[model samples]
Target: MNKIKNIGIGLLAVVALSMGSCSKDFLDEELTTKYSTEYFETAEGLEALTVSLYGNIRWHFGYEWAYGITLYGTDEFTNANDLTNEMWNTYDSRLGPIGATTSTGAANGNATSPNALWNEMYYGIASCNTIIANADKIDDEDVRNRCLAHAYFLRGYNYYRLTAQYGGVVLQTEPASGVVRNFTRSTEEECWAQVISDLRNAYDYFEGEVYTYGKGITWTKATAAHFLAKALLFRASERCDDWNSSYKQSDLEEAIDACSYAITARGGKLTDNYSDLYANWTGVDCDIEQLDEILMAAGHNADSSTSGRFGNRTYNYFTPQFSNFSGSWVKRGVWIGGMDFQRCRPTEYSYEVYDHVNDARMWKTFKTVYGVNNVADATAGIEAGDPGIVMILNTKDDHTYDSYTFGASKQAPNWTDDAGRLPEWTVGSRQTETSGSLTAETGQWVPNSLVLYQNGEYVASSFTSQPICNFFAGINKTDDGSRTAEKGDAHRDVTMARLAETFLVRAECYVRLGNYSSAMADINVVRARAEWKSGENRSYYSDGSQAFENNSLNTGSSAEKYIYSNLNMNTYYLSNPDLEVTTEASSLELTSFPSVLPDEDEAIMTAIGASSDYERALNFILDERSRELLGEWQRWETLSRTGTLITRAKAFNAEAAPNITAGKHELRPIPQTFIDGLLNDDGSNLTEAQKEAWQNPGY
Candidate 1:
């Protein structure tokens, strides 16, 4: 079943829990106020309610599975598996075509299936509404408002997700009364407007207090403002260039104001070490140095009985094989050499775009396997001869097919000529049987030929074979050596909304307004935090030598050469600082550019700078988001907002298919079942225009 159906069932269980109660003696007992509603009436009750809201954030979108599928499926850089293909087919992306399902009696609408992302989001919205309506009735004023704010933020956040995905949706401000609530859709504009207003209410109601989870139910001004900023920013992006749309430029201004408020209130700044922010999953356990950037994070405590099974532990999903050290039964056989598992792998495109040496993020993000040489090292001390072992390539079915064989030798070991080397071992037989007593000249004992069991029997010489490797098998020890912790998940965190994003958003707005100088300033602030050398700033033309002139910025051949050369050089230097720049340093130290450029050059420089700024902003935000929020379920949203869905689709399916057409594949189809169900029911109550409007394009 799909996640939505599962969550729906779970929600019913919660309702059942809410209804069942212990009976009270009516006549004999002394009069006492009922504590049923009172259970959620006090500060402690409200606090638990709010924690539940925060806890909901972790599973907001089933981030683990969604992120893996959408991020890889949308891009040209990564490949999709069967599960991802199933998701992609259901979504708007063209990487996979939709197929039929027997249970639903339709091509796509199994509400019980996990792909019903739409249903899951609304369920969250309903939960938030319950909290909001009930919290207001509490006697404690302070506790009441905090709970209300959290609920408002959650509802608004959920709506934000909904509008972004489905465009227009039925806005349920209050809890549904009946088990089956059939509601009509709201306009996309109406949905966003409601989202804005709800967030604004959260901001206003929680203004004075420092809201925190577990302490007491009070909305800290910071959390409210942060989400408020996010809502505004989303609105601004939608309406930035398209004035005819429901969004307005005022929204952008509001976003900037809200973000500014958050910055001032929290005293937060982006940290230099991007990796550390994610590595420290629990904000409390983070190093002192990293505390500045992490505004607020969902905390997961593994030891607590309250923690869920999938809660805090970084399982086999993201870690490399070596670090896990669990048994072979659970090992996925993919290990990060020394890195931590963050639950997603970077696409080749992501790795290529990064500055490997200076970025620091790349090293912390991925691990390179030493391949066969390392395997040889673990095998009996006898070094495997020529063509030093190449690490086995990890295939799509690596977890299912690959196996370790103990005794294999070259059939032409004693051959000196090419003709002799062309024996069975060199041709069809890449391996030879070795007896347990076969001793090398060095007196090292060879192990008996070890064959993996296939279909419950040993497969002696099968090359293209499928053998399941047990990840939970206690560490393997052979006479050769020992193999422990063979595979593990990677450890990296995905960052979604950070201070740098705010800066870049402001930079984009300033550039649009022709405020070049202001734009440059905002751009530089983010660069400074990234630890890019001050002198390497792209703002100025030369190292305090020549003042920038608008027309001159791109004119002279030397000037063009210098700028292009420097930009490329800087990118190379930043990405790979380990490499030496021998030739350029002799003539001029390229790193010594002036910090500020002249006002005249602001137009031209700002254009170039803005382009760089935008690319960096987009790339950094996406990359950082991928790195920090790897399993957090923001990939699809990021792709949708950025309009990179088709680009991602092409990248992800490069090996198997061609690029998908952009416009046709961007938005998801209104599920066929939803369309048919809606059309068949209650059309008699609708106007012609309303009915037409209800249908999605191409339906």
Candidate 2:
């Protein structure tokens, strides 16, 4: 075993072992050599159990499983080339009460099932129960209250996730001692109440101070308050219409107040630079978790030997297969541009949500240029340190090349064709009408793949003008070039909640209560930060890779000098007088609800045909969330809580639209493994009718 350096080292191993080996029961076992009732009676045991709860958060949010459940089947993304887990995104008939299994009848956890999330959350809840049960053993009042607060926050956090996906779940507040299978489900209303109550108690216990028990990665008062506000918002939403009549107005008011408190609590504020929040390229030395914007995060140490089992494997999911098309610019051995797992591909609506002309976030969030640094590109008449593949998110009409005209319409050339070679010259239509008619335009990008250029002539790709599966835009948020191996886990912490999201949450509350002006006030804060400011180099970009190679941010001490000092931030820029055109916009703020949709975004507008002012404002807020928090692992729940999952998915997501139903697709079916193991009060197997009743509707 690795040496224990962090707070969660002691009990996490035992929790993992218990969860992996025991599959018949739900959170039924807790085994440790040093753990006993007598040992738990001491202060050290309570502290260890509390720390293990934090570690359990890491276990729950690890790798692609977390992404599959939260991000897939939403409007923002669809299954990429790698369709190993396509059922999650497609919402086909295969997504049912019975979870996925191998051909040999063994349980396959993350392929197409929510069992992994279910087990991990319940296991963490078991640990939280242990801490709450034994916190009184500590003699120090302050220490006892701190440990209790941590337990309360984590328990509420787990239940919050559980109820969001599985509407009504088995709520167990006490630690399970043995295998007992006659559990019943709690109402969704009861579950949300528990979440709100626990989080409120946790906030009161923390005494209005931000606390960090681990390596600056534990929950604080602000974290608790943020969740509390989120819970209130969810309860007040249409999802809880069955029971939230009396508490709707009060919930909205309290939620708005909680958002205000969370914003100022513990010196929390949105970071001045939006890129600074995700610039975690220095492994454990990176101060991302310590930033004032972060409310809570799952800690992962840089040293794999001690960072627990799944050490930030999320770096592989959002990245596209860059090595397939831009092989000369990116190599597997030299500079692997993220692992190309290609799990989550951005939809057409995802790219269309941004104001590509004014929003700097679109450029910073997605990689559009692949600079060559290899000798192989010379064979294709390209020199080193030149752009090999440049993606234009606009239509050909905006970037027509006179040399490449076809029939009445002219074709747009790649970045090499523009004589100006200006950095801001990459403007064009988001997606032109495919047949030059309004009826034929789906708003999806046409001719998605580019024809390569060799010696100033077009070279046909392998797909013959079709958009290849492996060739798509890459997401820059999860980029981590600091890993030593191509497929190794990352060293950065997984961000869960932040101040910007808190502001958005408050804005959402305001929208729900018919306060459109206040909602826009909060939305403008984030939008203003995303605007391209004066005196800023518009071409200089870093998706956590350039920042690591050149240390352009001046991150660390002078001793650690990384390679590629020549690849400074401005290496990709070209001196052009027209660069100032990008800053011509006065502001990115929206003064009122958008009544008319632009031609490019007509598809999304048609999908959500809002007739009321309230619907228009709410839908606009949802789009703003997509613009700000894409691939942040919160899309599915946001849509589900707002009761817009079906409408939005039907409108934007091509794969999920046909299979999604109104009432059936909102909540995930309870895991069939757990349902099959249920017993009656007489200790007999549950009847088939009873089993069907226990499952979610339409499962």
Which predicted model would earn the best TM-score? Answer: 2
lDDT of 1 by residue, 680-699 (tens): 23333444454456544442
After TM-score superposition, what is the CA distance of residue 15 in candidate 2 from its true location, in Å?
4.7
Candidate 2, run of 10 with poorest lDDT:
431-440
Candidate 1 lDDT for residue 361: 35
Number of clashes recorded per candidate: 64, 4
Residue 141's lDDT in candidate 2: 88
TM-score, predicted candidate 2 vs. hidden true structure: 0.82
TM-score per candidate, chains pooled: 0.59, 0.82
Angstrom error at residue 444, model 2: 28
Model 1 C-alpha RMSD vs. true structure (Å) is 16.9
Looking at model 1, residue 138 earns an lDDT score of 72
lDDT of 2 by residue, 57-86 (tens): 666455657687899999998877676567
